[model samples]
Target: MASLHAFANPARFLKIARPLTGWLFWTGAALIAFGCWAGLTQTPPDYLQGDSVRILYIHVPTAWLGMGGWSGIALSSIAYLVWRHPLANVAARAIAVPGAMFAALCLMTGSIWGRPTWGTWWQWDGRLTSMLLLFFVYLGYIGLARADREQGGDGRIPALFGVAGSVLLPIIRYSVVWWNTLHQGESIGLASSTIDGSMLWPLGFTLAGFSLFFAAVVLMRMRDMLARARNEARLRRMARA
Candidate 1:
């Protein structure tokens, strides 16, 4: 709690992140490049889905992080509300846009994979519908955060939405099991993965790569927002003089 509170100071946060961001960015890049190569070139085609299953290497990881990022936002929002930490609010806001991007990517990739396997672009299955809802929730968070700078900056609006969204997350996750649907139930991490070892390592690496990328982007965005806040403060002081 103390450590989190300390980072709430924008200046203090930047001092640490400035040096750390470079390493995180480059390392994430390398991991992503290596993972993409391994996923696309090294992994053999799936026995059942063939080449299309390759999409899982990226799509699955993105979906995982989409949910993970929302969790981050929710946690940060809690901190922001309780601690009134400006940096926490910035961090939460920074995540919303990128999280939405990941959600959209997941949906598109899933659709492409489905077209090859499910014989249609989309189905109103438990997983598919829940995923769609998740994407819209991300968009809602991003849009609400950006809707009015004055109101949004107050931290009330986004904070409420963030809290509400967090509550909805479990519903999304369990929707597949709760409803009888076309979407398969927990086959991999969610349940016992029938995926072969040949494909699993590369898929695992891709998941790590996507997580690293998300961390890097979130840090970069937070850093930029802190700088903007600092510059605005400086200008305001100058104007008062």
Candidate 2:
């Protein structure tokens, strides 16, 4: 909490983030490269779904990230609202687009994987229905934030909506437990040997890589947002002059 308070200052964060971006960027790239190779080429075919299961390597990670990204936004929104953290607001704004994109990827890849496996392009199952709601929430958050930016005021309105939208995550997660679904329940968990060890490692790496990818993009976007803010301020000053 103390560290978050310290870093919530934009000037302090800029000084630190600029130096780390190079290393973080390369690390994210390397992880994605290794994860892609491991997922596509090294991992053995599934006995049940065969090569089709390969899509899980991408679909699962993206789905996880989509949810994870929302969690970040919600957390940041709380920090911004409570502590008036400028950096938190910036992060919330930056993450919205990428989160939505990842959600779309999850849906699209899942759709592709479903056709062959389930013989249908879409399903109204609990998980699928909740996931669709999640995607719309992402869209709504983005729209609200962008609209706030256009309106020339504090971005808190959209941030509040973002925090509220995160409520859907728990519902999406428990939907399978509450009702029947075409989508399978939890994949990687203790006491469950559903996925073999060999395949699990690559999937794990892919998840890590996707997470780092999200972090990198959010950081970059945050920097861009800051730069735009600075530029807009300068432009307004000149206009006043």
Candidate 3:
């Protein structure tokens, strides 16, 4: 796409990303604080689930970012493989750590939510198990990318792996539907949700906040990678001189 190429130049990308980074990070932090406060203190408890339902404010966003992170990797991987765009590869590598962290957070928060709602600390349910698999997939991508870099290999292998890892995304999404599981069926929809309005608004802030924060992190990582590359190139030049 024309838009992707426009920012493909690392210099151009950094110019734009640098300004947005601080804004995104601070705004996201503010929203997270406010959203958590509101979800914990302002909203009424669910008649059935009570205050434990508050964790959804955090749990849902982590799960979303966990899956969303892989989606970014797959897309970036496609761009890198198809166009040989270097920044696309940078993006895929940058997303790995945060994606993995979010996936781990999702599992942790899900367990906390489960203990109260499901009457257990853990379950081998479809959604939970698939999400755990996604976490490991993130780990694999991170390690694979590092190994590829250290060996002086072209990034295609990791890009290919990124593409393949996407197979798990759809499986994770539909796991609850395909199986009768402890995890509840999807309650949110495009136009409506089973959740009441008061209990739901904080989720909006948390999701938006976390997404912004994730973008900031990826950009920071990309910039760091670019700086390292530049430094290495300079060192190589000095050695030859």
Candidate 4:
């Protein structure tokens, strides 16, 4: 807890973040490029789905990160509300845009994949509906955060909303099982995965790449926000003088 609080100092955080950001961004980009190549060229076409199965390379990672992003927001919000850590709110605010983008990507890619396999563009299934709701929640958080900043309001309302919105995460995860949705059940599991090792390696690489990409984006946004706050403080001090 003490160590976590130490990062609340923007100066201290920037020192570490500055050097790490470039490394993460380039490495993630390289990995994602390699993963995409391997997924598209190296892997054998699925016996059942054929070439379309390659879409999983993109779709699965985005879906996982989309959910993971909101989870991050919820956890950060908890820290902000409970311990009053300054960085927690910044982290939540930074995560919203990329998280929302990934969720939107998931929906788009899912729709594309669905047309060939499911023979339809969409279904009002539990999984799809819940995922859509999650995207909206991300938008809501972004808007509320913006409004709070504009009004110079305390962060508690959005923090509470962040916590409350977490209820949808579990539902999104379990929707395929809880209801007979058009969506399929879990392919990957804690105990075992249905995916063969042949395809799994590239999938793992892409997931890691995307996750690193997300981290890089969040750090960059945090740095920008910190700089803006510092500049605003300076302006206020000058005005008082």
Candidate 5:
């Protein structure tokens, strides 16, 4: 908590974020490349999924980030609303675009994976539907944030929405369990994974790579936003002078 507030000063945050940004971006890109290479070339095709199993590398990560991204937003929003952490709103807004993107990618990749495995390009399965709704939620948050800024309102409006949107998170997670859906139940868990070791290793790499990439992107966006806000403040001071 003290550490989080320490970086609340935009200047201090930038001090750390600037150097770290390039390292994270480059490292994440390298890991992603390596992960994809390993996933494609090193891993054997699943006896059940054939070559299509390769999509799991991309699909699983996107899905995790899609949900995890919102988790970030929710936490940021909470920080903004409850603690009034200065950069929290910027962080939440920064997270929206990439989060939505991952959500959309999840849908696209899921459809591709489904077409081969489930014999269809799309389905209204519980998991799929809830995920689609999550994508919509991301869009809504992005739109609301935009509108709030245009109206020159306090950041609280979108911050509230970010908190409210989190309600969808649990629903998406449990959709498969609650309904009879074509989407598979959770294969990975904190303690154990149902996935075979041969295939699971590459997935680990891809997941780590994409998550790092996502964090790098979010940091970049936050830095950009803070700079813009600082510029706007300077301009306002100039106008007053």
Candidate 6:
């Protein structure tokens, strides 16, 4: 709690974020480039799925980040509501755009992948429907956050919505297991994974790259928000003087 409070100061946070952002962004970009090359060129095609398997490289990482982004929002929202941390709301706002983008990407990629595998472009399966709902939740949070800023309302409304929307995460996660869906069950897991090492290596690289990229983007957004806040404060002081 004390450590978190220390970071609540935008200046202190910026000191750490500024240096880390370039490092993270470049590292992530390099890894993503390598992963894409490896996945598309070096790795052998799946015997059954053939070239279509290459899409997995892009699809899986986006799907994971889509969920991860919302989780970040929910956690930050909790911090804002419970501790009244100003940075928490800023972090939540920063996460929203990337989160929503990845969610939409996941849906589009999934649809493209589906056309090759499922013989159709769409399915109302449990996993797909729940993920779609998650996208909607992201949209709702973004809208609410914007409204709160414009109206000068405390961010509690969006924070509460963030917390509530978390219920969809679990449903999205377990949908494959709970229902007989076109989407396959977990191919990767902590205890063991069904994916071949050849394929998994590129996938691992992509996941790492995407995760770092997400962090870099969120930090950049936070810095911009903090800068705007500082400018607003300075303008208010000038008005008073």
lDDT of 5 by residue, 38-105 (tens): 99999999899899999999999999999999999999999999989869999999999999999999
- Steric clash pairs (candidate 6): none
> How close is each model in CA RMSD to the real structure?
1.7, 1.5, 0.9, 0.9, 0.9, 0.8
Q: For candidate 2, lDDT tens digit of each residue in 1-241? A: 8987788778888888887767677786788788778888998988978899888878988889889889999999998899888888999988988898998899999999999989999988888888889999988888888888898869789878978898899998888778888888787766776788777777777787778778888888999999998999999999999
Q: Considering lDDT, where higher is better, how would the candidates rank from best to worst?
A: 6, 3, 5, 4, 2, 1
**TM-score of each model, paired residue for residue:** 0.93, 0.95, 0.98, 0.98, 0.98, 0.98
Task: Give the Å shift of residue 141 in candidate 3.
Answer: 0.6
The per-candidate count of clashes, in order, stands at 0, 0, 0, 0, 0, 0
**Model 3, range 66-121, lDDT digits (tens) per residue?**
99999999999999999999999999999999999999999998898888788998
Residue pairs with colliding backbones in model 5 are none
10 residues in a row with least lDDT, candidate 3: 181-190
Model 1 TM-score (2 dp): 0.93
**Over all chains combined, what TM-score does candidate 5 have?**
0.98
Query: Which of the predicted structures, 1 or 2, would earn the higher TM-score when compared with the native?
Result: 2
Candidate 4 lDDT tens digits, 1-241 = 6787687777789999999999899888988999999999998888888889898989999999999999999999999999887788998999999999999999999999999999998999999999999999999999999999899977878898999999999999999988999999999998788878787778877998998899999999999998998899999999999
**Model 5 poorest ten-residue lDDT run:** 1-10
lDDT of 3 at 98: 98
Question: How much is 94 displaced in model 1, in angstroms?
Answer: 0.5
lDDT of each: 0.82, 0.86, 0.93, 0.92, 0.93, 0.93
Q: Residue 44, candidate 1: how far off, in angstroms?
A: 2.2
**Candidate 2 lDDT (Cα, 0 to 1):** 0.86
Give candidate 5's error at residue 45 in angstroms.
0.6
